[model samples]
Target chain A: MDADLHPERGMFLHRLNPVAKLLVFSCFILAATLYLDVAVPLTFLVLAWLMGWLGARISPFALLRRLSPVLAAAVGLTVFNTLFYGGPREHLILTLGPLSIWREGLQIGGSIGLRILCVASYSVLYMWTTEPSRLVASLMQQARMPYRLAYAVLAAYRFLPILQRELGHIQAAQQVRSAHRRQRGSWLRRITHYGIPLLVSGIRQAERLAIAMDARGFGALPTRTHYVRTHMRPLDYIFTATGLAACALVLFALGELGLLRSFLAGVAESLAGAPQ
Target chain B: MAQERLDLGLARWTTREIIVMAVISVALGLIFMAYGVLYLALVPLLGQVGIMLLLGFYYLTGILVPYIVRRPGAALVSSFLAAFTELLAGSPFGIAAVWAGLAQGAGAEVAFALRGWRDYRLPVLMGAAVLSGVFGYVYEYFLLSYAVLEPTVQLGLFLVRIPSAIVLAGWLGKVLGDGLARTGVLRGLAITRSAS
Candidate 1:
């Protein structure tokens, strides 16, 4: 809802069409998934942060604050991969009683962790800058998504806050009725008790809303005109071209230096060879 | 309330059907966002398997929507909407959530597709959940680099995820569908029409 209401600050990224932004980000994400090396994703991570700060005009502190939770999760991933690493125990990093951390484990874990960060950073920037209304507009007009489905999604997006408020009311009413009088129930039980009422109220409201929409001939036309049209501009093309060129150049350099490790290649070797 | 004739043919969805599924999916999306955070916290103890065990929640919309709506692509649409909602709400996983949603939804839909999109019986629902778990695992195998992990660990993940999918998504979806049908709010919906 907040994203829907976000005033376009007229930043470069904000001015670009959502479709262009999606193309550029998807390019980077696809690159991250293809390569398994640490340097590749590390390069992408830095590039993503730089774009967020300079392109989107997002303050570094604000970006870091938003990324803190993801940072923590990334670190957790690193630790998990290191501890449970089933790879060959080569280039010992450290050792404890029956527990050891190896270079191979750390590399695999760190690469995956950094990849997650890279993807998250791009997505955060895009989500922060793009308006939901414009996103649907671009999706319908540029992405060729059917208007009916797109509008259905937009209608659902609008109902989120209402649903949250309804949830609060359900919890309060149940609490007053001494639903927690005895031992507290499991989280599953509690959610179910609250979920049913929430679902019923939401369904009833949705049905009423649907009838109102139908009355207004919401789906009468296959293609409808938009008040604010989202179109691809020259600047959007430049941005996409520049973003993609930078990624390709980086990958090219990495490949020449023999630092580029293809993920599929690694998987093939791992599967073909026995556990070390 | 008069029982409307159940139209099991692959007809175009009405506005009512679309809106109803969206609302339900969005609600589930909100709940799953909480679980996603809890998943990150539990990684230290349970490792990646923690996510696998908690995966049934992710598969819920995929199963629930098709069970109630019984329409072609209902599973995929609702599941995708739920994930997209999580993305808009700023889930920690960001864009990856959308891809996971697509894969899982497609997997769940396969069961109904095999059943010719008609059966809403318990077995088909559970089968949908299992197929979704399978697809989720396969997607993560490449994206999350699960291929690099020890084969046994990968096996462990597969073993834990199936049952979790069954109990959490399949059985729970049935319960929720039955509960909503009982409330009479689902009167004009396909699930109620078929029952009556």
Candidate 2:
């Protein structure tokens, strides 16, 4: 819940329309997955850290801590692909017993690692900066999302924690009934006996909620007014254009300039055909 | 006009359906949160085959929603909304969680579409569930570029997921649907209406 987006209303990034930020960030991640080239995404990963402090007003240490899973996943992915999923065992780097790590494996694996880092950094920054309500408001205001669907989703978002608490209460009550006293098949037994009743009650609550919503004429109008309006400021346009242009120049266009794929491919080819 | 629209499939969601889907999504998002924890912990073991391991468990919304609602595109919308729930609740992967929701939901939708969105037979549910797994992995494979991996390894990844999908999305969906129907909790749903 803490990471779900906080609307503190500070900094240039926070002021930008959530829709613009979401769009730009999504475009950036899309570009990363497209290339699968190492240097490109790696550069963006570094840039994301810098942007955290300069643009988004996020601390560097906080950014790093939040993005640690991505870093771990990158390391784990590199190891897995390099050791397990890579090419025809060409250009051996290390060998243990029957397993051999090839140079091509390293190239592809490292590419995936860098891609993860780049995408994760962008995503972490975006989610950290944008508030969830702002996101929904923008969707409805900008994207013309139906108020009924959007509000329902928002109300449901508010309900998740309540449901978690309800689940906890149910578990405690069942534990008092000695549900966990029997160690054998406790979890499986609990899921059926506990989960169903919980869901049944949850649905009943939602049904009642729908009735309340109707009583208020929740979706009687085609266009409803917002108490918290989201307007696209000059800052939103500037941030989006600048962010996208930077990503394209650094991640995609620069990769084309260096011909990164062919260079890696050539290095791989040489290693594969290298003489013993 | 309202009842006619519902029958003709012109209307996608009624207010009641929206509430129901939202509620279902929150409940299932809890399940997703648990899986996400397991995933973060077991990534080493999951390795390249990480996606298939999630096939069976993740798409339960796809099956349950469509089975109960029987509305056009209910499966896809349900899965997506469920995923959005995970996002609002705070997903580690951020926006990719929503993209994943779309991918998995579409997977389940494919199976139901093949049956012309009419059948809720055991085989139909099972097929949808398994395909949801296939589609999820397929989406990630392309999205993450798994084409570079060995063909045999790719095949193995694809194969291991089928059984889980069958159990979770396919069989469990059917079982739970039957149970809910017996409890008369699914009263006024399209499936129940069609049956009675």
Candidate 3:
């Protein structure tokens, strides 16, 4: 919600076409998916983070702060994989209950966690740098998406903040009414008491918004003048092409290194190579 | 004078109503997002907990939002709002949230759409649940499950997920909605009885 986190100017990444970025990002994900190598994925993740710092001009610490939840989840996943999803590798790390903690499982889990982190980081970078309106515009202009559908999606995006504000107001009122009631009730009871009014109000608001849009001539025109236009600059093409090339090269290198086969074999080989 | 009063009462900014609803939606969204994060985080510790938790959140949103708003897109908006909250909260699921939100929203919307935008009875709510559950199953099968397991196991898991979403999440949502209506908060909204 902070405007500073998504600044209006001076971010190089923001200037590129959103559709291009989306394509490039998808390529990266696809390339990452083709192989199971942690190195390639980790490298990509690092590169993304660096791009966020250099291209978006965001502080690394601020970016990391935003990414803390993802990091925690990744760590949790790694731990879980290490303990429970033991692979067929002969290298045993530990044992618990019926599950044998193998080196391969841990390695595979760590690789998976890294892959997720990489993908997520790149996506976060895209979203943080690009304004939703510009992104929608790029989609329409560059990708030739139907204007009507694009507009509808944009309208929905625009309404999101208003809806958030409305939802906040609803919760406060419910808390006040329930203040006199004992707080010792079960979680289910409390949720029921509070959830009803909010739901009713949200529906009412949506209805009003629908009416308001209709009244204002939204969706009335099949074609409308562009309030915002997105043009694909030379840099956009360069960025897209370069990013895709890099992603392809990484995939090729990963395959050549035999890490791809190891990755596809599941947790078995990953754990075997973990300690080394 | 009476006409003027009626217009004013109906059309005026009722800050109290707006504030109350806004707060509830945001709070519920935050809770759902948190649960989603926990579910994803605990996937290794608890197999399939992430899917179940996500389904539970969707079910709750579908039931609660429609019960209160009693209008078109309420369920859809609620489902998406919950997803948005998760994204804002920095979900580990990343951009998958976008697709998941779309699918979940559509599921809840289909139920309301089927009733011709008129009914909000228990059966209607159940219909919404079933629709949402089925959608969730299809979504997981293609998007998440396919990458991890065999076709048979994936299909079986999908079956498990659907009923769990319907019975656990869907039923709970309906019960919660009804209970709240009984408390008189939903006095303004029209209430319909179940045909059964």
Candidate 4:
């Protein structure tokens, strides 16, 4: 994996305070939920992807490649929703035995799938731009979160790669041992034979980590100084304020249009008429 | 050098147990990631069928952790650890992973709490499954899925998840634990003693 995708790179978005980014993201999600329409959220996805290109300097191809899994999932979700969830005022697109594809269902599913894509894109941008360590430090400093807990989270994050590497080593060692024993069992048995050592090592690693942290007086201090501080710049303020304003404007437009309850009402009406 | 305490009866790990747990965690995490991808992929068509599967994960993690660590908060910690693993593996859920961790941990905690932190009987395990399932359902419905679902539909969905958690998640966890112990690797964790 490229180091740039490590969520710890010093990119434009990475420079913002973690707490500020978190709040902005949260507000964005809330606004998306409130709008209850596919268009706005889908727009957010496009905007986020664009920002990744312009602001973070991530290539468009790279961004899309990273988002392939989410895109594939959205397609699957849309299909499932259209077929099984028939509703009132639905335009029957397709039908099979007991399963009917409804227009209303497609709209609803598309809305949801788009919302997920938008939310996911925003997060990917955050992770891609921000360093995990900086994010954790900012959370502790700006949010007044407990340092012990924050550091614990950081520790866990850092430990993951180590664990993965160790797991690989253990597997190789097991394969060698199994070969010597001339193990002629099935794949499942081979897996069982190899798996036990990895688990034991993981537990031992955790214990050692805990002991090491304890020895360092990890939880002893009431407060600690950060080697690096996150100071929000004028640009961050402008970005966040603009993001919030955009959310508010979208919500206002949705409310004024009176389209908020239409989807849910349609769903309720369809569910009620369906033969049990 | 201090002589290491060696007890053959305790079933000391010989590089085998460590590998097994790591594989299990990875496999479980991968399965979860696949389900998560499916949940997101299917969302455009169905609301979230795999959402119910989350309850099973909570139940399984709760039982599996306690079976391994035999310590307070083992279930909770393990649940978070697993979620963290998934997130690191690039779960699309983003920060929602944190909330999932908390909910799943709480579910397992409830099960352990019901046992008075003493008993590990099947009934207690089942009770834990139910408790954890309910917690997960409430969180998902109220926090995540509430806006999408009507009030009655939300309640119905919640009700349906409980049984799925108990049967699919809880039962499978027990069986998996038994299988792990039979491998003789879990003997080191003292889970075998509890199994009998």
Candidate 5:
């Protein structure tokens, strides 16, 4: 899956251990969830974008273009919250028959929207920086994940493009066999029929892979030597420290803005609510 | 060794089972990419009112992996890997996609664990799917801000999505599992005597 993306060479993120990058990404998202206020998350979003621009070596304009679909989701969810959340009807900004949008609804919607933008960037950046082989290798060397599982995962990661190609072949075969009836059915038919042939081919290939790996003495040892050692270097620690300090700074800022409990409670309460 | 391997109670993942997990996840990951296009088109059109309509497409790896692999933690790895696949394939949901995967994986993992990882029957598997739906639903509830909606609207969304889960991930997952089983594709791999 990391086959297509080539991170700019010698960039700070590309040099960081894949595990460090993943940890930073995970911590960023987890911390971003702490606030219901827009500023905190929106700040995080801008910070993430800046990290992409400055550290990951991505162009800001191109990054935004790539993230536009995610931004669209933020817009969709925000619109939904504004219209249907329906808080204190008197604060209504607009009304269409039974549908109403309130000021509070907009605020709440915007917070979620900002969170969406803030959260999605973590994955984008992580995927951008970390190669899949490096990720699995890091998991093995740093986290002490069993090499059996790690190499198996690497092998599986290589299966993605093959599966995609096989899927195209299956559809083409089906098209030749049933050209007239193909377009008439639901996507369910197309997907379901497509899944079987792909799966069948997939299982066959998997069995062969398992045998090949075993024959080559894969997973024979509890641990194995690494050709590319993945460890946290000084720069990785700097990246991690910078991420931690940034998180602390955001929380303190949220506290200083005095929008602590009520901000998050509103969201938690909304989620915790169920039909009486 | 074969007998021990066949026992689902043994949480140990063999090379074969790992490959199976990876294979299914990669294939489904491609499907997820396809599904993402359909979802992005529909989400804006339906807005919040139909957000749950896509519920079925989510949480499937949670169901499919455990049934096929019959290992403890298989569901968790499957869902997570599948989510990772979607993320790699450029899912717009991004990190929340991983969040949903983690939550659903944990949920389905619990369901299978309750059966001691020994049960892959249709009922047991479908039950796991529904549980995964419940977990996936809760993640979306906050992540998508359904929590901020009116109580009635929230209930309406929740009610519709659970059944949609029943149809899409639950029923549809079972259909695929059974189809694969009947072809003798999974006969020696899974301990179960009959795919049906």
Candidate 6:
């Protein structure tokens, strides 16, 4: 799955254990969720983008292009919140005919939108740097996932592209066979027709592979030796420390500005004051 | 005594079963990517509540895999893997996708567990799908700040999701599983033994 279209380029994040990266990035995402203010998550989003550019060696243009879909989602969310917001309209931001944007709605929407983007940036950065095999290896060694399940994931990961190609083939075959029919019917029918063939071929190939693997004594023992190790170096700890410090720094700055507000608290307040 | 023995029997996972579940997840992961695209396109026209109509797509792996594999953890493992696959496939939601997967999978697993890992009837499958919908909704309620929305809109979102779960994940999963069973590809699996 990590076809590495944009190769790691021997960047800093690439050297850390994927698990360590997962841990650090998760903190940033968790922080993104807790705060209701736009600046906190926006800061995190900028920091994530900087990490992608400086540490991960991802080009700025490429990052934007790759994240274009997220941009759309953020924009959609902002627009939805700005328009349908049922909050007090005391601080109106705009009035484009029947559609009016209020300050409260805009703040809430912008915060959530930036929050989504911030989360996606960290996730994309992690996936871009980490290799699938190393991730599975790390999960097994560090996370203590069973070797059997981990190997199954690796095998299935290897089959993804093959299954995609088979799906294309099935769609083509079904289209050719049904060219005579006038009505294509509902989307459900189309899925079942194509889904059955794709699943059958996939299961058959999986069974054959499973048999081959078992014959080789794939899971003969409870524990297996790792061919590739994903060790957490001292640098990984330092990197995690840096990420935590950055999060704390942002929160402290926001707190000093009196802008740090818990999103859950705000929601609870609104619900409490809402009409029954 | 019989129940304890049955629990022991169902707990073990064979290599074939694990591989098959993984394969099914990868396929469904691809389908999920398609649904993500369709979802973004429709969100503008349908708004938030209408988009719940597609939430069922997310639960397919959870419901279908358990019904076919009839294993205790099949739903949870398969759905989690499917979500992981989607994340790897560049899902915009990223890590949250896996969390949602875990939540949905656990909800579906509860339904199967209630049946003692035995029944795969349509009703049981539908029950599983509905539970998955409910679980997913609770997650989104906090994550997306659904609580801030109007009570009516929230209710509408919850109401629309149930039918979507029923038709898309539950009914559709059973249909696909039955079709695959007829093709004889599922010859060695538990589904075949139970059906015969």
Worst 10 residues of 6 chain A by lDDT: A1-10
**What 10-residue stretch in candidate 3 chain A is worst by lDDT?**
A1-10
Model 6, position A127: C-alpha lDDT score:
83
* Native contact fraction per model: 0.55, 0.35, 0.10, 0.07, 0.52, 0.46
Maximum-lDDT candidate: 1
lDDT of candidate model 4 versus the reference? 0.60
Task: Kindly list the per-residue Cα lDDT of model 6 for residues A1-276, writing each as its tens digit.
Answer: 223223235789787777778888989998988877788888888888888899878976777777788888888887776666654446877889987777877887888888888878887888888877777777777766667777788888888788879888887876787742633688877777778888999999999999999899976765566667666678988998988898899889888999887777767756675432
**Chain B TM-score for all candidates, comma-separated:** 0.91, 0.85, 0.73, 0.76, 0.85, 0.92
Pairs clashing in candidate 6? Answer: none
Q: What is the TM-score of each candidate against the true structure?
A: 0.93, 0.88, 0.69, 0.72, 0.89, 0.92
Clash count list over all predictions: 0, 0, 25, 38, 0, 0
Q: Which ten contiguous residues of candidate 4 chain A have the minimum total lDDT?
A: A1-10
What TM-score number comes out for model 4? 0.72
TM-score of chain A of 5: 0.86
TM-score of chain A of each: 0.91, 0.85, 0.79, 0.80, 0.86, 0.89
Top-down DockQ ranking: 5, 1, 6, 2, 4, 3
Q: Model 5: residues >4 Å from true position, as ranges?
A: A1-8, A86-90, A179-188, A259-263, A267-276, B1-11, B90-92, B191-196
TM-score of the B chain in model 1?
0.91
Task: List model 3 lDDT by residue over A1-276, tens digit each.
Answer: 112223246678877777788788767755554444567667787777788888888776776777787787668656654554433555888877776767666665676667667767766776787676777666666666545444444544445566567657766766777652675677666665555554555445544655565677654544555657666678988998899888778767867877664434543443353232
Determine which window of 10 residues in candidate 3 chain B has minimal summed lDDT.
B1-10
lDDT of each: 0.82, 0.73, 0.60, 0.60, 0.73, 0.81
Model 6 interface RMSD, in angstroms? Answer: 6.2
Decreasing TM-score order of the candidates = 1, 6, 5, 2, 4, 3
Highest-DockQ candidate: 5
